[model samples]
Target: MALKSPRFASNAALQNAARSAPPIRRGANGQHVAAIQQAFIDLGLGMAISTKKAGKADGIFGGETESRVWQFQARMGLTRDGIVGRDTMAKLDELLPTAGPPPKPLPPAKMTHKINVHMRSIDNPTVPEFTQLKVMEEIYAQYLIRVDVLTGQSVGLTPGEQFTLNIVDGDCKWDQVSDEQRLLQNSGSNQGVGVNDIVVYFATVLREKNGETLQGCAGHAPTRPAVMIAASATDKTTMAHEVCHVLLSSSFTPVHVGEDANLMCSAPMCTGQPAYLSVAQLNRVFASKLLHKL
Candidate 1:
């Protein structure tokens, strides 16, 4: 016959029992299991138990609770048995907070859109130092943007797949190139870009008419959109700048307001190195369909 759990008079009694409690094997049920489960949750090892199924620390030492205890044992470098014996209970007692319960986490805001990026490299087919994680970090640091990579691969660019640069002298030809031309020219082996997603290609070289090198450039295609960043533009802020252009462009017109120390303003025009978007620019980004707001 299965053994029934021993009941306690109160929580103080349960906690006191937990300090010197005996082995809590499967099939046992009582306030002891509830106390142990709550202790597990408070210690930041919550994945062990299915809270939804267990429901407010049900006083049952069943398979689920046993499994949770086993996980806790494994994490604590103890025996992996599915039993909470004297040693396990002692460890739990040692780790349990002496103060109040753990603070509840705030619910994350709903993500409006997920920007799927296709990272392509030139000749050697090498992914840049600026990875998807770094990209997410940069964009999310400033704007409330939700971006992710399509697949976890540094796709190789064939001989033909190169960023098309406009030949201009004494100035950056970033705006001279159209989004349509940029997409069509670099549309090599890019069969995974979704309708709402964008492609970011890292090219070998991007020079002007007089061989003047540019840091990076980007354009937006309302019909077919993509952003081509120079591999030389290694900084995260540069990537953020180009991406901002793609998502927050106003009717293909220059939204970059010069004379301000912001991300939109570049060198010579602005008094700083890396800049940021203005309040108006932020409003534009927040209003865009690409971003999900709180």
Candidate 2:
């Protein structure tokens, strides 16, 4: 069914109803969603703020809206849990303007890249190809980029080819493996990809620099644009996090200390939370070589 447009009964009635309503969550729909969407816009965050794209405030608490909620929570130093509970709503009420010139919208980036993502796996046969593609779509939507995700046949995990990675303390380091072995593992499982494409490899496990188990890896290659996501992490945000790395490259630091909620923050404090890209990181992605904005 089509989500109805926001219909406020009256300014006073709307405020009272929203102020007294229960917490809002994913899949919520109705006037409350509309009021919250308007609140985000009033705060200068824009519509579909998490995606940073123009979209209707169509009174449905879908993924994009959920993300924006968490982003708002993060910025406000609230719980960052993505739930629009009473506390969050109260904060929103306090911050939203009573009346004034509407906050200025962020200017659109001049360039937007149209890119492709190729999926590959090694020693991990059952890659979450569809789920990962959905992640890429949602993430690119944030930057207003068009993405084409291409799935490749699964490879490796053969009886003799399965190699156990070295683990240091609690981390698993794939880089500890010989360069030749890493090259062979990546190359042998490869599928043809496009010039403006990134190869996403699903691995059984990923390790930190010291060989501690990490969630994923993202870096540039002479012949390929690549990011590796550990099938084990299981957090929905991990894939998008690594992809942000591939797009932002070394120009930006891997982590932002004060901005733990930003997509690029690798701090332990930010662990376990969904991450959103900072405006600067969004601009860097637009300027990156990996994307030939079309």
Candidate 3:
């Protein structure tokens, strides 16, 4: 017979591991396995129903794992398809944090709209160093709202979701807390997140000469709550680019040249970096269709 998990160790110990940056794919014993028996255990989730079909203790995913994932998706208020994609991953990361339950909900899911979200916008905030970053956030936010409205799931923030910019200049300790953070901060000059409705954007020590090196970086959505991170608003173009990443993060991947519109335009159009004004201009209907399914 397969062995059951031992009892919970010190919450302090778990917190310590979390603080020291525990491994993402580990068991209660915190050792390597062919596959994770249940993800919840690693994330400090105990005795949750399995979403996969295999035996409850089976390492690989089965029906039970699927079920639990859907429940998680719903509780976290995401599009629950049972499959753990970027959106799901973002939600999980936001919720199953080793530090304990993730941060409190930023806002509640408002009216479920049947309308396709046309792009929305807010006045661009003024910032000298990260001007591009700010524009990117605004534009990016509009992009997500538009996509959610169109896809029939406006997974953006509710009203009152505030955004704060926390800059830890020369504070090496900020990156020293945990492995996950250190890993991100090591390469996170262009990352940001929507905390509840409050999107907290991050800029790292690497943002020099206005984040030109990170223009290629795109936003990512993991399984958890609706959160995202983008490049700082220091560079002139960083804001717009990062905003595009943040808004398009959940339903879309900002990278993937194949996803770009095939519109034949008189206005300048760089392969991946097109001014995303109207979806009507998008010649790639196939990509747009695929985005909704995601």
Say which candidate scores most in TM-score.
Answer: 2
Per-candidate RMSD, Å: 17.5, 11.9, 20.3
Query: How high is the CA lDDT of each candidate model?
Result: 0.51, 0.57, 0.31
Write the residue-wise lDDT of candidate 2 on 172-209 in tens digits: 22223345236533656555676657777776666555
- Lowest lDDT sum, 10 consecutive residues, model 1, at 1-10
Model 2: what TM-score? 0.55
Give the CA lDDT, 0 to 100, for residue 159 in model 3: 37
Candidate 1 global TM-score:
0.47
TM per prediction: 0.47, 0.55, 0.25
Evaluate model 3: give its TM-score: 0.25
Question: In candidate 1, which residue pairs get closer than 3 Å at backbone N, Cα or C atoms, i.e. clash?
Answer: 262-275, 262-276, 263-275, 263-276
Regions of model 3 farther than 4 Å from truth: 1-195, 207-235, 250-274, 278-294
Task: Give candidate 1 regions above 4 Å deviation.
Answer: 1-113, 123-127, 131-136, 152-185, 220-222, 250-254, 257-261, 268-276, 292-294
RMSD of 2: 11.9
lDDT of 1 at 104: 43
